[model samples]
Target: MSLDRPAGKVPLLELEGLVKHFPFRDSLGRRRGAVHAVDGVTLAVPRGSVLAIVGESGCGKSTLGRVALRLVEPDAGSLRFDGEDLLALRPAALRAKRREMQLIFQDPFASLDPRMTVEAAITEPLILHRLHRGRERARVAELLERVGLRPELARRWPHEFSGGQRQRIAIARALASEPRLVIGDEPVSALDVSVQAQVVNLLGDLIRDLGLTFVLISHDLGVVRQVADRVAVMYLGRIVEEAPAEQLFLTPRHPYTRALLAAVPGQGGALKLLEGDIPSPVSPPSGCRFRTRCPHAQALCAEVVPELMGDAGRESAGQAAHLTACHFQDSLPPATPIREAAADARLARLQSFFSTNREPTA
Candidate 1:
């Protein structure tokens, strides 16, 4: 649970102007406007580090992950992996390149085949990649042990394992290829709180031990804080802020980023609760997508789009690279600390009551 930074080197994944739109159709199949699921996303994943893409639901983080793996074809973008053009690759070549990149989905049960045994499931990738073929069973046992599961559990089916176990199996499958890059789209969100911590630690260990580059997509800031070396805050299919995890959390530049940090429990700050529902992506606001709900929005915000820029005044190298996409980012009012003694007392009483009344574990 240390907040130490990752020592990542060269870029493993490079994406520029990535765009993916899902078009809507009428009853008669008439094409209508498209859903801007992913729009102009530009990012880089450094080798042997974890970069987290976080935002509210439907901000296109999931779609961006799938698009990175080519699970969903992007309409427009430049994707380069390890100095090779991903978009220019043929089908057969792309299939071969997949061994270098893999995805760990959110729901372990849904992603895994119910009928497949643990051995069959974990070894499928090994078989596909034609690795350790003659001794696949032994390799499966090794992978099981690597993920903190017993070798004998290879005989068990998906139904017999707990939620965390299933996720471990999924992780093993992803690692069976010995991929250089792994994209985890809400991989730990489905597990219980206690189980979530175990999986998070497991992933952190795997990434460090295997020298893997990770892109974690999640809405949970707490989870992001645990594993990410860097973070990108997305809104309406665009990244509004990108910075080192500690710097971003300590001094958030964008108003939206500040609002999100304020919402976390015990993180005392003025809670600037965002007003109104998120606008439909199909017809997002013309200029700043978040202007509709931004407290500091002005007439200029509606007429011009702000580009993501690094902080010019920050002296620290890491803080200097903190990017924020707001025209008046420097002018935004600082958030005051929340001071509600009565509320804090009430919350403490409620927590104590819950702890006393909780059911004992077996």
Candidate 2:
């Protein structure tokens, strides 16, 4: 993806301090509490770029994507799409703007309407936008082939196709309205490994072929590294680190970011074993959200929150100069154990630590 921007080119999408909270009700229908699904998320995606948001489940990545696209309203903050204020839009205007933004969900099996034929599924968006009328039939047929499905499959239901093909159909439907932005939330997580690659490759081809800006939410590091131009690491409800794909892979700054990298299937060789588990989002630890899981935690780490991940300069020794957030500047080295042996190492270390350490306090 092209990184250079024209002198005055505005980002295709921007979210400043976006926040979302889902309220939970008791049996009496009284508001009991709220789930902080997304909090203070800020990001910008340039035109024709793919920005992948990576984090474990329940880290608020998907919620941020939905809020960015206005699929869900934010509790606070700004969302601008194509220079228009998303939260400020009226219902009718927002509905109209929906044509420019679409979402590709995670589940290919359950996301589709079982009763609808492939033709109807792909043409619904086109019909809603009034982009094509009597032409929808022909267009559906063409889209089927464009997504690598035969025209004969148009009459069939979603259950009739393989997972990969269904995902392709989903892609076709997302493209039906000729949207400018597509938020793909774990688009291939539900498919087989090989099929996952197929879907990812298809998305990569589509993004390049159509010049579409994508906000990809995924937990798959390999896929993100391959398909994303830039990557954002989210923890709890905030972004801890972000950088170009190559840079992040080569060097991650925040302790949380390091732990996340270590957790990747083959990233362990790049660092020592990670220290702890990610804290529950509902009750995140005080100060640095990641301190509870970070091995580098110290008195100050628990008192002062780290900034966004960036490179070394003022940050701790291990942090990259451009890394956005890091509290310790120059003392704490990065934890890179190389990933191949991570699982075995982690297991061995866990066994040894448990054997040597005292029992947990109840």
Candidate 3:
């Protein structure tokens, strides 16, 4: 959570120029335009740190998470994990690499097999990786306990557990392989507000205690604020801003990011609210995808695509640089503090609950 950590170290996972598109076909079976799910996204997650990718629904946050783990093949990109080329790996080699990376999906109900008992579900990974061998049950029990669930619940069916408990089981399954990196796509979004905090606290503890690198994909800014070390703000399949969690929340540079924070209930700011719906990904705006809704958009915004550039003027000594994709980020009017007298103070109280040293409970 500290912004003072020095940057420039090699990351555990590095993705560059990543692109994934889902093409459709006409009645004649001929190919039509593709849905630009992820376009030219480059991001890095340092070892033992948490990077949260935040955006509204359909901005390609989930697709980016899947592509990062190679569950979805990218049309173009360079992906390196632990300093190795991920794209060049053969199927068999990629299967082997799966042991080091896992995903905790969004819907726990769909993620778990109804017929499979809790133990069987959690042990599947150990079986696939040829781990724990004859000790699979023991390992499953240990994993169950680690995620703050009772080991005895291993025999229960997925349908028998509550939403939060199912998510804990999903977490246990993700960690069964003892992965070096885990991508959680909306991991706690479906849970109740109180339950979300419990799961977030558990994840924070596991990431810290076990030194696991994590990439969180979620729209819940409160959850992101509670656990993320850094945050990437995505819009229309592209990242518009990236900065340390505290810095981004305090001084967002991109118009899209500022609007997002301002839209949060009880937060007051001078920024204009976004006016229109998000443009279809199949045919996004020519240049800046967000220009259509951005109040600061000018004629130049429609002609030239803005590149993500570091804000050198705002960087503090030894802190990670804040990067913004707005062409006139420097020339733009300064942002007023978004916090208002009636600002949602509950978020801070909620964050403190999950961020403390107290142990997680069921």
Best by TM-score, which number?
3
- The regions of model 3 sitting more than 4 angstroms off are 1-9, 268-271, 340-362
Report per-prediction Cα RMSD to one decimal: 5.1, 10.4, 3.6
Compose the digit string of candidate 2's lDDT tens values, residues 77-126.
99999888988899999999999999999998988999999988998898
lDDT per residue as tens, model 1, 1-362: 11233554347789899999999999999998988988899998777778999999889999999998887889998888987889999999999899999999999989999999999998889988899979999999989899999999998999999999999999999999889999999999999998998899899989889888999999999899899989999999999999889878877879889888877777564456777988999988988999999989999989998898876777454333678899998888765433334557667766665445566442
* 110-192: candidate 3 lDDT, tens digit per residue: 99999999999998999898999999999998999999999999999999999999999999999999999999999998999
**137 Cα displacement, candidate 2 (Å):** 1.5
Which of the predicted structures, 1 or 3, would earn the higher lDDT when compared with the native? 3
lDDT of 3 at 129: 89
Which candidate do you rate higher for lDDT, 2 or 3?
3
After TM-score superposition, the amount by which residue 269's alpha carbon in candidate 2 deviates from its true location, in angstroms, is 7.4
TM-score against truth, every candidate:
0.89, 0.87, 0.92
TM-score quality measure for candidate 3: 0.92
C-alpha lDDT of all candidate models, in order: 0.87, 0.82, 0.90
Q: What's the lDDT for residue 95 in model 2?
A: 95
